[model samples]
Target: MPDVTKAIASDIFSGRYPAGSSLPTENELGVEYGVSRTVIREALKVLAAKGLVLSRPRVGTVVCNEDDWNIIDPQVLAWHAPHALDDKLFDAILET
Candidate 1:
């Protein structure tokens, strides 16, 4: 459950699912992760607790804005750290 939560959070940090964008349906995520919908639901709940996402009735889960994120949370910080490398790498490539 923690792994799935981290994976989804990482996706948000990496901009794969930007703020205000709805995540894939639970069914779709279940298929992608090979887990049951219940597991996906729990993972979503965790993300919500972290202020990384919000659940909208009939609309699905949407990522929260950067301002809404619990950036000070240790887990959130750790999950977001790796994504910073992507920007640095891009800058390096552009300078070459």
Candidate 2:
């Protein structure tokens, strides 16, 4: 479950799942990760708690803006890829 959560977070940090973009449905992610929808659901919850994503009433899980991310969170920092420190992240680091 943690692996799935980290993989999705990595994708987001890598720009593969950009902010304002909706992530695939739980079923789709389940298929892609070979896990059950329940696992995907839990993973999404973790991402949401980290401020990396949010659940919309009509839409599915959507990635939040970079500003909304809890960059100070150790787990979130750990999730970022080695070369993912873009301008926004650099600014975030400076701000902190």
Clashes of each: 0, 0
Q: TM-score for all predictions?
A: 0.85, 0.89
Tens digit per residue, CA lDDT, model 2, 1-96: 999999999999888999999999999999999999999999999999999999988888999998898987888988984647778777787898
- Local distance difference test, candidate 1: 0.87
Tell me, what's the RMSD of every candidate? Answer: 6.4, 1.4
List pairs with backbone clashes in candidate 2.
none
Q: Positional deviation of 93 in candidate 2, in angstroms?
A: 3.3
Q: Candidate 2 at 45: error in angstroms?
A: 0.7
